[model samples]
Target: TVKPPVETVEVSPPETPLIPPEKERAPSEKVTPPLEVEERKEVEKQKEEEIEVEVSREEKEEEGKGELKRRPEEALERKAPERRFSIKTIFSPLTTITESIRKRKRRTTALEEVGPPLVKPKRVPRTLKEELPPADWRVLKEYEVRGGVAMIRIYLDPETSNYIYWVIEPPLSDVEKDNLKRLKDLLQVSLPYSLEAVEEERREKFLLEHLDKVMEDYRIKMSENSLEKVRYYIVRDFLGFNKIDPIMHDPHVEDISCDGPGIPIYLYHRDYGSIKTNVAFPTDEELDGFVVSLAQKCRKTISVANPILDATLPNGSRLNATYGREVTTRGSSFTIRKFREEPLTVVDLVENNTMSADMAAHFWLAVQYGESMIFAGGTASGKTSTMNAISIFIPPSSKIISIEDTREVNLPHENWIAGITRGGAEAERPGDIGMYDLLRAALRQRPEYVIVGEVRGKETMTMFQAMATGHTTYSTMHADSVKSIVYRLENPPIGIPRVLIQALNLVAIHKQLKVKEKRVRRITELVEIIDIEPTTLEIVTNQVFRWNPRTDTFVYGGHSNLYEKIMDMEDLSRDEVLEERDRRAEIISWMVKNGVRKFWDVARVVGEYYEDPHRTLSIIEKNPEVEGNPLEVFERAAEKGRKEHLKAKSVAA
Candidate 1:
C-alpha cells in the first residue's frame, strides 16, 4: 500500500470555451459570396432585355393592327394555357380509373394455380328434321286475335313420333319463329306444322277427334278396373272437365249433409249460413262412392265393417260418412262441416242479434264473478257457439280447464288447458275415458274455472260436484229451458240430484227462433237457482231477467235471489246495494260505449273491476268521460242521491 502511494499522479480540471455572434464579426471580414452576386445581376439583366424586346414587338404589332398597346411587363407575362376538350376526352381520366379498378378486381378474383382447369364435353348440333319421324299431327284447339298472339293446342301420337308429344304453341313473330327453329334444331326435335294448325275452321273438328280418342283411351283404362262410370262422373261433374258449377267455388259451404241417396243435399253455407242444395244422387251406390271419394280426399278409408268414418277433408272441413246400412238405418249418409276462416266471436253474436247487449254484460259479470252457468239449447241452437263466446270472458290470468268432445272452444286466454274426449272404436272394448274422466281430471288441476263443451253423460254429475266444491264452472246442455235442463240432468246418465242442481247460479236458455225467416239464437231466459223446493224434487227458479221476443228487448223482472243473498251476506244496506247495482249498470254502459259488446269483453272488464272495486269506482268517478262519453255526471249525481238516502235510512235505523 505504501509503494503504490509513492507512484500517485495529479490530474488538472477541463478548460472552458466561448462562442461569438454574427453582430460581433471583424470589420474587414466579407459576408456575401462573389458568385452569388454575379448570378443575381445576370438574371436581372436578362429579364430587362426580354421585357424590352417583348414591348417593342407588342408596339409594332399594335401600330400595324390598330389595337390597344400593352405595358412592357404585362406584354412579357405569359398567358395561362387554354384548355379545350371533347366529351370523350373529358371522361378519359375517369374511364381509365374505372378500368384500372375493374382490372384489379378481376386479378384479385382469379383462381389460384391449385390444379389443372376442367374441360366440359362439347354438345353436338343436330337438325330437328333428321331426328323426327313422319307423322300426321293435328291442332286440337286454337284461340287467336288479329294483332295479338294465338294459342294452339296440338296432339301427336307417341308411336308416330316419340320426341314430340303435346305442344302448346303461341303465335310467334318472324324473329321468334327463327329462334324457335334454332331451339328445335339444337334439341333434335321436330317443328312440323299440321294442316289443322294453318286452317282455323278445321281446328274444332280436330279437337273433337282428339277428345274422342282421349275419352276412348280413358274409358278403356277405367273399364279394366270397373271404374269407368265413376271416372266419367268425376270428370263430368266434379273436375269440371266440360263445365263446372259456380257454386263449387264458394267457400262458405262448410258442410254438405245428405241423409239419403235420393234426398237433396243440405249445405252449411257461410252466408245465408245453411241451405239445401239442388243436387242429389240417384242411388245409394252412387252416394256411397261419392262419400268414399270425399273420404279418400281426406286421406281416410271407408269400408263395410268400418262403414262410419269421421275424417278431415283436404280443405280442413270435417266429414262424417256412413256406408251401407251398417251405421245408418236407411242408406249411405254423409255430413261435412266446412272449416271457418274466422270463427264467430261475441261481438259477432251481438251484431247478429243473437243476444242483447245487457245479456252479454250479465254473462260477463257472471263469468267474472265465478258463477257457475249452464247454456241450455237444442241442436243448431248455437250451444257450442255461445259457450265459445262466453269463454272469452275468463280472466286472462286465471287457470282454466276446458273439456270438450270436439275442438270447438277458441279462447284467447294464454293460461288455459283444453281437453277433448275420444270416441270409442268398434273393434276393441271402448275405453272408459269419457267426458267424466276429463272432468274429474280437470278438478284435480285446481283450476279457477272448468268448462264442459256440452254435457250428455255422467260428466254432468262431476261438473255439478265440482261447482259445489268451490270451482266456477261453465257448460252447455241439449235442452230449451231450465225445466228441461233440470229434467235431463236429474234423469238418466247425468242423474244429478235436485240439491246439487241448486249449485248452479244461472241457467241461460238459448232458443233457435225463425225470426224474419232467418234462424237466430236467442237467450230466451236467464233463470237463477234460488233453492230446492221440498214439495217437488225440483230447483226453485228466480227469474232474474227475461227476453221479450215481441219487443226484441231484454227485461229485468226482479232482483236475483242469488244477488240478494250475496248482498245480505256482505251486510250492505238497501241503499248501498242499490248504489252498487247502479254502479254495475254504469260500468256495463261504459263498456258498451267503449265498443265492448261481447260477453267476453264485458267479462274481462267486470273481472278487473271485481279484483279492485275501489280503484274501478275511483276511475269511473275521476274520468266522467270514458272513451269520450260523459256518463260520470249522471253516475255521480245518482251516487250522491244514494248516499243521502243511506244517511236518512241510518238515522231511522
Candidate 2:
C-alpha cells in the first residue's frame, strides 16, 4: 500500500502555490511611475502646501467672526486627486447615484424657500417741472388718466379767500414721483401765506407760458378771429375754470339771447318759462360778440348780406335771428321756440281743461263718419292739438294721408301715408311742391281721409276740392268764427267760394280763454254748414250745447242732425239710437267708476264696441246688476220703438 501511494503521489500535488504578500497588495496602494517619480514627489509637496493653506483659511474664518478681516480670495488653491484609479472606476455607479440625489434635494429646498418672484412691470412717474406754474398752485384732485396724460385739478387762493380751481395737463415721466414731491414742497411754502403781491407779478408770466397752448386748441376749433374774441370774453366773464362744452348742454335753458355787445345776456328758463338769468355782458360790444358766437353755433350767417336767419338747432329747436342793420334796426335779436320732449295727447288736453268731453265725442263721431271738418282759431289756441286728438277716430281699415310743412300729425293707424311739402328757396323758384301739390297728389292716391296741418294760401281751394271728391278731410285755419273762416277763404289769396263752404260738414271754433289766471282752450261754437243763399250762408247752431263762460260746463242739446244721420245709417229708430248713445255714455261712466278715466282706455272700449257690437252688448248684459247696465236700457228702448212703429203702420193701414 505504501509503495502504491508513493507511486501515485509522485509529483501528485505540486502543493498549491501560495501567493506572496507583496503580490496581494491592498486597494490603498499607490502606484508611481519610475520615470515620473520626481514629478510625483513635487505633487505631494504641493498637496502639503495646500493643506497648510486650508488650515490658514479656517483660522482666518474663525478670526473674521470676532473682528474685522481681509477677504479670502488668495486662500483657495488647486489640489491633486487623493486616490488613484481608472476613470471608469473612479466614477462608480454607487458614488454617482448618491451625488445626484444630494444635488436634487438641495435644489428642491432652494425653490421651496424662495417662492414665486414678483412679475409686475415698473410704473412711470408724472412730473410738473418744465412748465412750472405759480408756487401757490397745488394739486387738489386728479381724474381720467388716459393716453399718458393726467387731468390734474389745481387750486389757487385769491384775495376773496375763495379757492379758484383749474385743470392742468401733466406729462407722465420717470421723474414724476420726485417732481410731485418738489411741487408739494413749493405749495406748502407759498399756499398758506398772503402771496397776492407775488401772484400778481407772476400772473402775466404764468399766463404767457400757458396761454399759447390753450389758445392754439381754441383756434383749431374756431377761426383765429373768433379765438381772439373768445379770449376777451373768457377774461371778462371770469370763465377760466368753466367748461363751455358742458354749459352748452344745459337742458333747462330754452333760449340764449344777447341783444348787443355790452348788453345784458338773457336765458329763457323752462321752469320759469321766461328770459332771465344771473349772467350778463358788460358792454354792447361784448353782446355783439356773443351773438356772433351763437349764430356760428347755429351754422348760419347773420350779417348785412344775410340779415334774417332761420335755422334748426342740433337739439331740434327752431331758431330765428335778425342782424342789426339788415333785418332789424336794433343790433341783433333772436327767438328760440323750444322743442317738446313729449307731445300732448287727448287725455292731456282733457286733464288740463283745454277741451270738453262733449266736443271731443262729437269730433270723434265726425271723424269716424268721414265728415269734412275745419278747425278755426287764433294763434296758440291748441288748433293742432285738437286736430291731432280728433284724427285718432279714423277707422283702422281706412287709408289716411297727411300733408304739412313739417311732420306733425302722429296718428296711430295701420294704413297711413304722411307727406311733407318742400319750401322753395325764392318766390320765383319752380318745382316747389307746396300744400297745393300735396293735396293734388293726395287725391290721386285714393286716400279715404286727408289731413292738412294748416290751410293758409291757395291750398284752401285744393282742400275744398278734396272734400268735394268724397274724401274726408280735416284742416285748421287762422280765424275766430265761422264767419271769419268764410271771409278769409273768400278773400284774395284763398278765393274759396261761399257755395264750396257747404261741402264742409262742420266748423269748430276754438278760442283761448284766460281762466283762473291761466290760458285755456275751449270750443266756443260748433256750427253745421246748412246752406248758402245768394247773399248769405246759413249755419245751423246748437247754442245750448255751447260752453258756458259763467259755469265752465258744456251744455247738451236734445238731439242734432248728426245723431239723426247715425240712426238712419244703422237702420235704428230714433229711440233705439238714443238708447245706444246712452249705453255708450253709461259704459264710459262705468269705466270711470273703475278708476279708468284715461282717454286711451275710453278709446279702447269704443274700438271694442265698433269691432263686435253684439259681443259688447252680451258682455254688458252678463255683468248686469253692476252699475251702468247699458244693454238693458238698449233693449227697453228698442222694444218701445218697435211697438211705436207697429202702431204707426196700423194707423196707416
TM-score of 2: 0.51
Per-residue lDDT of model 2, residues 1-653, tens digit only: 11221112112111222224466435443322222333345456544221221111112333322211223433122223342211221123555434433433211000011122244332223322223545765544334322222232334444433332232332333333332232222232323233233455574344433444433422224445544444433322222212222223344444556554333335544332233222334433444455555566555566767666655554545567776645565466666555444445555555555555555556666777778988889966778777887676677778999987655577667799998765421212476667777788889999999999888787788889888888999988899987788788889888987778778888878897866654467877777775666554554444325668888777666656677788878887887866665665455444434444344544555666676565555555554444454444444544555567689989999
Cα deviation of 203, candidate 2, in Å: 39
Q: lDDT tens string, model 1, 1-653?
A: 11111122221211221113544435443333222334334435444221111212211333332112344333222211121111222123555434433332211011112222244332224423123323565533333321222121223444643222121212234543333222222112111243224355664444334434433432322232223323332223333211112233344345567787666556654435554443556566677777777767656678897897765554445568889888787788887665554556566676677776666666766776778998888876777778778777677799998887545666767889988665521113366357777888888899999988778776777888899998999888888888788788889876877888888998888887766666667888888887877987667787877878787777877576655655667887756755666676666555545555544444555555756566566656665555533434434544665577689989999
Clashes of each: 2, 12
Per TM-score, the best of the predicted structures is 1
lDDT of each: 0.57, 0.54
For each candidate in turn, the TM-score is 0.52, 0.51
Off by over 4 Å in 2: 1-324, 424-428, 534-544, 578-609, 613-653
In model 1, which regions exceed 4 Å deviation?
1-255, 260-263, 268-274, 279-301, 310-319, 424-432, 565-653
